[model samples]
Target chain A: MLGYTLRRILQMIPVLLGATFIIYALTFLMPGDPIAALTGERPLPEATVAQIRQAYHLDDPFFVQYGNYILGVFRGDFGIDFFGRPVLDLILERLPVTFALAVTAWGLKLVIGLVIGVYGGLRAGKAADHFALVFTVLFMGIPGFVIALGGQTYFGVHLGWVDPAGIRAGWPMAFILPALVMALEAAAGLARLTRTSLVDVLRAEYLRTAKAKGLSPQRIIWGHALRNAMIPVVTYLGLSLAGMLGGAVIIEAIFNLPGIGGLMVASINNKEGTVVVGIATLLVLVYLVFNLLVDLTYGLIDPRVRI
Target chain B: MTQLLEVRDLRVQFSTAQGTATAINGVNLSLEHGQSLGILGESGSGKSVTARTIMGLLDMPPAKINGGEILLEGEDLLTATAKRRRQLTGPVMSMVFQDALSALNPVHPVGRQIGELYRVHRGYSRKAAKAAAIEMMDRVRIPAAASRVNDYPHQFSGGMRQRIVIAMALALDPQLLIADEPTTALDVTVQAQILELLKEQQAENNMGLILITHDISVVREVTDQVAVMYAGRIVEQGPTAHVLGDPRHPYTLGLSQSVANEDLKGRRLPAIEGSPPDLLALPRGCSFANRCPLADEQCSSSAPPLESVGAGRTSACFHSGKVASNVAYSN
Candidate 1:
């Protein structure tokens, strides 16, 4: 197991490197002149323009810039933002907001997914299964941004319950709408996945043997079936976590929430190349880390999954 | 005589794309305490379904038992509540399935799984359960019982896993054990070992065992009574020795003759012609009528109910009323 894990970590290095390259190249091609954005147009001199270009290494060839950035990664120097702030510091500041939103959404999805999945799986072909089917259809039929809109109109505007337009002081009200939207998106897929996995696992011969041995339905489920069914959910959840931050961008925009997502949009609109790159890099890192955690969880859930 | 288990008019139907199909139809059987009953038939003969129905483990939506009475020690299992039915399983009754590899959970320790009967139903603490598991492992004669207790199901061979299942079944010393083709996946030697272990466990606990299998020779060594199933009903049933010694049902006689018993060598093996009928489109007559040598016009129009042929034997055939070995009828 240890050897398998070490090998997996080694295997991920190239994947991470490849992802970073794509992000770097894609950002460069996005048609933004960071030098022009940073140095204002009024009475700007040619020498100052060249200096601005040199400062951010935009004057260098594309391959050279890529090579230098890859090398700079090892030295912990991701260069400076358009406003001259350190990229790392900028990323660290926005990290908590995105983390809080994604984590809360992920947690809610896990709880709701497991409950619906197990219930539908246990009483398969019954009302629970039908209810789960309908619930999943309702959420999956709509996109995250749409649900965010509906939730704001119904719960925030019509009901006058929540501050639909903006994220407020405390963490509770701040995360409510964003988390709900993300969960609605996640729960739809998860409920369907849970139902399929639960049904399959419950029908396994081990479950029958457990039944033949007179173990209670509750014991069979909690002790054995649920653990096995969590495998696919783990993989799905990990991939979902990677995209969690991205999903909040539109919802955060509608809500006027000054979270990392809003910061990302503002940074892009302002042509803050360093901030955009920094946030993108942070997302890539989150993706890698969550993938690793999922691998570890697979081992915990079933010994057969070595890595 | 106190019957340990009785299954009367048990019919299991399945709603399929074709229509409602009866898998087991009006099957009647009885077994006494401390006795072993062997149910032999080819695949899809409804043997496993019968055993599953008796255990109350059949998933109900697609599988519906139209009518039946599964009386286990005078308790009607057919209408029993889920809780009551569960209570009758494990220590009271258990089953060993055909495929051992798939039967045990791959991720859990075999011993811990075996000990779970005590842990879940009996409420034994983890440590106590572990100890009891080791003891049960030893009783089943698993080598290095203490050391191997923590080994997962995949670590054991096919035969050994079946023994673990048997040990698990008898751990709580249930009154009845239903073994559905327990030796089907095993080699000759291991099959013998498993059968011996099961027989030992049954005798030691005074338990009644219903062994379901497609192979008749495997059950000859241990079972006291034998029931032959065709399509979805018992065609013949009697004391194993009497039935094997002087077979009555044409299907039963043909089945035993087809097998290469020691004395029946040096002759062309009498193979039954044609395949088993599909339950969905089964004929209205005796299910075995097409394959029977004694089949006639009367056999094709209507099905025959199980009728007495001897003092303690019954067969579902119209003409075979007397135990005449010379009676010959062939299609």
Candidate 2:
């Protein structure tokens, strides 16, 4: 198991490099000069531009610039943005907010998804099952931005539940509504997947054996069926966690949470390649780690699966 | 004293997309203590359904008992409360299913599965149940039961897994054990081993065993009495040797001929022509009329009732006298 984990971690290096390279290349290909954009109204003089370009190695080819950036990254340097602020510091500042948001959304998704999914699966072809199906379809059908806008209007403008936007009101209060909005689509998908998986597991022949052994219906479902059903649900939840941690740019924009997502968008618009590439690198690491965790979790849930 | 089990006019039906399909049609059976009865049939002949219905394992709504009384030592299980039935299961009666790989829960250790009976029915402690599980495993003849107790179902071979299932079913030493095609998924040699184990367990516990299977040789090897089923009804029933030796019903005669034998080498074995009748829209007359060579107007006009043809034997056929004479000509 230790060897497997080590190999998985080792495999992440190439993936991380590839992801960072793509983000850097895309940012580099964007039109307009960062230094020129920095001095928007009054353009910088030729000599000052040259000095800044020489210092930042902006005139070098893409490969040379990428090589320099990678070398700096190995030494824990993420370079600087157009505003002369260290990109690593900028990412670190927003890390906690994004972490809190992602965790909240992930928790909400799991609880809501599992509860509704299991309920629906157990009562399949009945009213509860129909309700779950409709609920999932409705949520899944609507786009994320539309849901965010509608939530803002209903909860913020009409009901006065809490502040419509921004994190000024504090940790949980500000996070709940946006996190819920962020959680909706993925939760719907998770609930549907859970329902399908659970329904299939419930009908498995082993469950009949459990019943024949004279186990009560409750024990049959909870003890035997749920563990097997959880295999696929766990996989789905892990992937969604990785996705949530990658950040929801639209939700962050609408709710105005100063998260990594918002930072990423603002940096891209300003052509701050260092900040964008840094955030992308962090997301790549998160994805790889969660994937490894999911694979490891499979071995634990099902003894048949060896690491 | 009451028999170990008695199923009188037991009827089972399934509501399918087409219509209500009568899977088990007025089947009657009785087993004495320590006796083994084999229910012989082809696929979809309701042998498995009968065993499952007896175990109360069939899912209702899709499957419903139209009319029946399953008496376990004089108590009508059909009238028993759901909780009462549950209490009876594992302690009073239990079942072993086909496909042992699917029958045993994959995630749990084989020992835990076997031990679950003691834990649930006997209220044994976890440690006690584990010890009992190892003991049951040893009884079923699983090698190194103590060491292999923690291994999951997937870790075991097919035959060994079936042994684990048997150990679990017999854990509480229930009066009745319904094994539905238990050896169907095993190798020929492995099948013999499982049968031997079952026979040994039955004798040791003096348990009434109902072996449901399509294999004639298996039934002959394991059971004392036999009931040949066709279209969900018992067409012929008597002592295993008597029924197999002189099959009174045309269907039973056909089934006996279908088995491969040394004398029939290089000769075309006579198989029962046509498939079993569809449960939905069954003909008013005999279900086997279409497939029987002796099917006449009388056989087609009305279904034959099961009647005594000889000592301790019953055959559901209008022309039982001719069945024996016709068997020689078929050869």
List DockQ, one per candidate, in order: 0.60, 0.90
TM-score of chain B of each: 0.95, 0.98
DockQ of 1: 0.60
Query: For residues B115-211, what per-residue lDDT tens digits would candidate 1 score against the true structure?
Result: 8988878899999999999999889899899999988887888878888888888888888999999998999999988988888888988899999
* Candidate 2 CAPRI classification by DockQ: high
Identify the leading candidate in terms of TM-score: 2
Weakest ten-residue segment in model 2 chain B by summed lDDT: B322-331
User: TM-scores, in order shown?
Assistant: 0.93, 0.98
True contacts kept of each: 0.73, 0.88
Candidate 1 has an fnat equal to: 0.73
**CA lDDT, every model vs. true structure:** 0.83, 0.91
Compose the digit string of candidate 1's lDDT tens values, residues A1-307.
Answer: 6786688778877876787788888777877676566555674688887877788788799889888877776588776776678877776776677778878887888777777777787778888789988887888888778888898899888997777776565477777877888887788788888889988998899999988888787888888888788888888888888777777667778877677788888878777755676677767777777787787777676766654
